[model samples]
Target: MGWFSKDIQTMDDLFVHQLQDIYYAEQQILKALPGMIDKATDPQLKQAFEDHRKQTETHITRLQAVFRMHGAAVKGQDCPAIDGIIEEAEEVAGEVEDKRVLDAALIAAAQAVEHYEMTRYGTLVAWARQLGRPDCAAELEKTLKEEQAADEKLTDIAVSAVNRKAA
Candidate 1:
């Protein structure tokens, strides 16, 4: 359903919709990470993608648990935002011939994905708390912290080597 669909009349409904949105986004990220890992020229960047892929699995599992806790159906709706981000990443990676520069692009793409996740998780945590689901909030907060750490790691990789080597 659309973000402002009439189906979401209550705060709880809004919370579930957000959950499904992020659920779909995380699945898409899982699918896209292998390509990122293979395309990354830097060992650190490749390993980072590999590590996050494993973490994404855990994130999906946690989301499913939250769904059960909230009594929402364990299913995901379409999330075009993530699709577009992955598509854009693929397009840029295809256009860049230099592997080092491609690594930089990949890091940028990964960070975009991480930032998208961070915003969704951050919102979900707050909404969960407001809806009297502190349990759900606590679960989502774990993923939020992980996403934040992933973004910081990307920035560190970028500044410490990837961006400079690309230049």
Candidate 2:
């Protein structure tokens, strides 16, 4: 179900909806990252992708924990945003022929994923607070901070070196 659907009419609803969204997104990321790792020409970029793949796995586990804490079942609904993002990444990766350019594209794509996670986590954190679940929010916040830091690192890779190398 979509976030604005009849099922979600409160902060708790939005929070859980986003939790499932990120959970699904992380699973998709786990499936997608190996290809990205293979496509990356730069060793650091490849390693970064690998590291985030592991981190995303942890994110899924954390989401599951939060669901349990909230007395909700661990499950996921379709997340159009993540699906679109990943599809666009695949398209862009396929379109680029040069290795350096592809690495840059991969970084860009990775950052897109990070940004999506940031928004979800940020909102979820607030929702958790609204629901009077600071413990849940704190756990979610840790992952949020990590995702943001990863985004910044990916931006550095793209701006400081990868995009320039590609160009």
Candidate 3:
């Protein structure tokens, strides 16, 4: 079902839909990271992907916990946005012959994923508060902070090294 489908008539429905969306997105990230790690030319970029893969695992677990707390089943809805992002990353990375430029592309792609996640988690936190589920909101806040930090780290990696190498 689409995000705004008939079932999601209440704030709680919206919150659950978002939670499922991010859960699916996180799984997609997990699947994509291994390829990104393999393709990254920069040692730091490779390490960052690897580290974030682990963090993504933690994020998934935390999401499951949140699902439990929210009294929802631990399952994911299909997220076309994330699928498109991953597909674009793969296509762009495939076209780049230069490994350094590929690294730069990878960082950009990763940051795109991070930004999408940040938006989702931020909205979820707000909705959780509106739903009077402060406990769920607090749990989601941890993931939001992590997503923000990951985005910043990717920016740092891009600015400090990847962009210059690509240039």
Candidate 4:
């Protein structure tokens, strides 16, 4: 459903819709990560992608638990934002001929995904608390922190090695 659709007439509805949105985004990320891992030339970047892929699995499981806890169906809605991000990343990666530049591009792409996830999880955590679902908020907060850390890690990799190598 669209964000402003009549289906979301209440805060609870909005919360659930956001949950479904992020749920779908996470699944998309899971599907995209393997290709990203393959495309990353830097060993650390490759390992980071691999590690985050594992974390993404845990994230999906946690999202399922949150859905159950909220008494919502465990399903995903279409997330065009994530689809666009992944598509753009793929396009940029495909265009880059240098492996070092590709690694930098991959890191940039991963950071964009991480930032998007952080925004969603942060909002979910706030909405869950406002809806008197502290239990759900706590679960989502964990994911938010992880997303933040992943962004920071990507930044570190970019600053310490990848960006310089690309340069």
RMSD after Cα superposition, model 2: 1.6
RMSD per prediction, one decimal?
1.2, 1.6, 1.3, 1.2
lDDT of each: 0.95, 0.89, 0.93, 0.95
How far does residue 148 in candidate 4 sit from its true spot (Å)?
0.6
Poorest 10 consecutive residues of model 4 by lDDT?
A: 1-10
User: Of 3 and 4, which scores higher on TM-score?
Assistant: 4
Please provide TM-scores, in order, for all candidate models, with all chains considered together: 0.98, 0.95, 0.97, 0.98
| Per-residue lDDT of model 4, residues 34-87, tens digit only | 999999989989999999999999999999999999999999989989999999
Candidate 2, after superposition: displacement of residue 143 in Å?
0.6
**Better model by lDDT: candidate 2 vs candidate 4:** 4
Model 3: lDDT to the true structure: 0.93
Candidate 2 ranges with C-alpha deviation above 4 Å: 1-3
Model 2 lDDT per residue over 49-164, tens place = 98898888888899999999998889987888999999999999999999999999899899999899898899889889989999899999999999998898888888888988
| True lDDT of residue 75, candidate 3 | 94
Better of 2 and 3 by lDDT: 3
Candidate 1 residue 40 C-alpha distance from true site, Å: 0.5
Q: Candidate 2: minimum summed lDDT over ten consecutive residues — where?
A: 1-10
Model 4 Cα shift for residue 151 (angstroms): 0.6
Error of 3 at 112 (Å): 0.5
